[model samples]
Target: MIDYNYVLRNHILTHNQIGNASDKSNTQRCDVCGTFLSSAYALKAHLQLHSDNSKPYTCTLCDRRYSSVHSLRMHEQLHTGEKPFKCEICGKDFSLRATYKTHMFLHSGERPHKCVLCGKRFKLSSSLKMHIRTHTGEKPHNCDTCGKGFSTLGNLRRHQRIHTGEKPYKCTECGREFNQSNSLKAHMHIHTGENLPKYDISVIIYSLS
Candidate 1:
């Protein structure tokens, strides 16, 4: 029989020795896969992939998150939510630049994605893939909080907030609640003196009663 207490003590001592060896060796590891991260910043970002606690880069339209600020800017259309990218044929609106590019094919009558099962065509490959998933009944995007299903990961992310009650956007002036930061920014104009646009007009009328 082995002395379990002695073995545990020895293991702890060895782990402490290794930890104190150098700062370069004490990198953060992935909790799930044990992948070593190079820097603390990278480790912090990698941790966000696991939990819904952090969202540094927020979308202006719907308060979505991305690893980079540029991605948030790209996601802003869901709010100005302006869908400037219009389909030439039916005038359908799309927030994504690529989706708009794909919609342009409607005017050209181009079918890029061909279905082998039913001889069908699609303008975008992603749409065709989603359509195929319907035949297979594939629902990969699921909400961890409420056990709801979504077709896209983005939709699932948006739904998860209902359970977490995580409203990251807040008005700086009045502390009002908003789903998106852009809305908070717009609300801030109420405090700033820029709420109304300037217009000048002069009118003179003479009437006899």
Candidate 2:
């Protein structure tokens, strides 16, 4: 099972980022479900790959469609019940592979994506692209309303809410609304009356299953 909260956080942090630049990748693959997205901007619309809304991939076995092919495959697993990620080398499937894949990068010491401007090394070409922007002062993401610039598309959308007065996030308990997700999370404390507990993301994912 996917820890949706963890996925949400990752989406909030990395949704503006595209595929690793040096890798010549186009997809912002979901870290949770391995769904390939052509654009980083589409992450929110997919709802962490678990939402019922806007599902385009349909299962021929049933009426259910899903936001991603990965999701559709997982759902079809309910009928057939097989699963998981195959290691590229040995071809053994694992329940989880994100950290394992990163570990391989470390084992090889292969951070191929380097910034030409600063000699900074990154495992992801996306990170390298973002780093390069710091030197070039490029703001590819711009606000249509105010003509303001942001380094990332996520930041641009977040800023746009100020102009539009739109609040998409709401407290489930109090029904109070907020323009940002972080604000909604912080407001949730009023109902719980405690600080959120710190749990390893793996622990949360384990509980979800």
Candidate 3:
């Protein structure tokens, strides 16, 4: 059902154009996939992905696959609970280097991705894409029970809980049930008497009389 060709037409055309423009005499062919590359360097780099020597390193825990040993070592951190990549600004630890780099943008106030319609900038491409949906009024995530639409999958999932009557969160003191976790925390504060100031009901009645 997915039209991958139409979706990746631009990417395919770029590679095909490069292959076509290269000299046929000097072109190198990939033995595995039969893809004609412009130079030996490109061909060699491509072959590294498919070579038998590639992906020699394997994860012992989950049996997840990786192309290189360095990749496998990085994957192992998920199981070992190691966070090597740390943000200098907030001191947040990330499991991967790419995640750490992305978090740094938040502190630097660098919004690279911009919206064409609203001229709003976002630090990440995903944030910009979500902002575009707001302008388009697009609600792709739908509730199965009520047929309600939401902008995000998380909002849709939360909406479904209303139909299911699933109250997962409960108060420890009074055993009061709440649909949301934040509501439960607020309810707990009522018992703790932390937020609200105590008021005399008799004082208002006496004043009125």
Q: Each prediction's TM-score against the native?
A: 0.33, 0.41, 0.49
lDDT top scorer: 3
The Cα error of candidate 3 at residue 125, in Å, is: 2.9
Writing each residue's lDDT as its tens digit, candidate 2 over 53-161 gives 6677889998887778887766776677454665576565544344356546655878987755457899876777677667655566769898887887888999999
**Candidate 3, which segments miss by more than 4 Å at Cα?**
1-76, 80-82, 171-173, 181-209
Q: With candidate 1 superimposed using the best TM-score fit, by how many Å does residue 51's alpha carbon deviate from the native? A: 4.8
**TM-score between model 1 and native:** 0.33
Candidate with maximal TM-score: 3
Candidate 1 — which residues are off by over 4 angstroms? 1-56, 81-95, 115-120, 134-209
Decoy 2 TM-score against native: 0.41
Per-residue lDDT of 1-209 in model 3, one digit per residue for the tens? 98764555433333432333244753788889676676788789888878656776778998777877889988898899899988877788998886777898878889887766557898888787677667655566668787787877877877788888888888788776766665665566567877633335443232223
How far residue 37's Cα lies from its native spot in candidate 1, in Å, is 24
List the RMSD of every prediction in angstroms. 21.9, 16.1, 14.8
Cα-based lDDT for every prediction: 0.61, 0.65, 0.70
